[model samples]
Target: MRSRRGVIEVNTAQIREVADGVPDVCIYELLYNENIEVIEDQCLSKRKCDSAILASDGTVGIFVKPDLPEEYRQFLLWHEYGHFKLHYDENMHFNFYLSRFSWKTEREANTFAALNLLKGEDIYDQNVIALLISKGVPERIAVKTYESLI
Candidate 1:
């Protein structure tokens, strides 16, 4: 099910290959390599929102809340990159209120982040899911991670 941004075609095989090649793939480094700028900001105080992506003059800027935990912040970075990769067009400025964005858009981004960050690991394993949940992965994300691996 694709959203209005269009179908986000994620090649899990290619992502796996890249993950295998890189020692430690940092999402920020990946964004940098793609010429996307990342800014850590503490000004986004909206509940349930930790990041935003702005596209202008052919450049994508990702702003992440700096006050979140390291793991959560990393997740947010990946989520925003998902938006950049999947939803953003060179002419589209994606900044909008969280309440205004469709749930499908949010779900797509969350699924993208879960799959990419987890690297198609078998997060469905109950023990592994529990471990991830205990380690601060949101329950929704844990479920999405499991679903993506399938």
Candidate 2:
């Protein structure tokens, strides 16, 4: 599916809106309806990336480093999905050795992932990291994303 493009000024609330569009969890199941193909690549992390997306020919593909634990793999998939939904510039590179992704963009993706993963949870009343862990978010990312959110 084509992204809502030209939105370079996205915020956490905006990401929340995007997550609201998704009716439920199990992103792996949702991607098919979104016309996104998922691929498990053993070499992804060898390239210095946990996950990445490739958009082409009216289909978006999310490639993940399968070596990661299942929870982290799911988180990475959501993160890349955030990129696809938000800043989906076709020219978005693989983020080369000389050109890392912008910090803000990465953070936005993580925020989207966290928001979506914990959509039905009461983040205000619980330990955020523990909550995220229960929902399959990695402890490190859960901690950092929780910290960033607060």
Candidate 3:
């Protein structure tokens, strides 16, 4: 799909194929396999952001607050990986301050994370939806995940 920021195209099925059963472990594995560095820095707490910065050296640095819960952290990592997979290049530096681009990019990344993390779940089942909700996933994301699965 083309957006004002740029052309955004992602093969979500391919990403699902790469994500294993466990979301956290799967994201970590994906990052390592892609040679993206995972960095946990408390300094990110000051930035008020939980996003990844793509460095000029082909390293994607994930800035996560120290106090972030495990599940949320996993989601953040996957979201960052989504940016790396869909938008970033070796020469591209992602600046979150670009408001229009940031919104579009963030939506795509959230979709990517939700689809990959919720893959194989029976979204048609109410129990599954409840489980997702219980895990602190936003209802919109859970619904979007169902749409993606279909």
Candidate with the greatest TM-score versus the true structure? 2
Best by lDDT: 2
- What is the model-wide C-alpha lDDT for candidate 1? 0.64
Q: How close is candidate 1 to the true structure, as a TM-score?
A: 0.69
Of the two candidates 2 and 3, the one with more favorable TM-score, higher being better, is 2
Pairs that collide, model 3? none
User: What TM value does model 3 have?
Assistant: 0.70
| CA lDDT of every candidate | 0.64, 0.77, 0.64
Which ten contiguous residues of candidate 2 have the minimum total lDDT?
92-101
Report the C-alpha lDDT of model 1 over 5-109, residue by residue, as the tens digit.
544344545434434543346777788788888888777766466788887778778888776788777777777777666566664444435435556566666
lDDT (tens digit, per residue) of candidate 2 on 1-150 = 222442355777787788788778588888877889889988775787778888886678999877678877788888889988877766654442233446767788888898888877766767888978876776777888887777
Error of 2 at 146 (Å): 1.7
Ranking by lDDT: 2, 1, 3
Q: Each model's TM-score? A: 0.69, 0.80, 0.70
Give the distance in Å from residue 17's predicted Cα in candidate 2 to where it truly belongs: 1.5
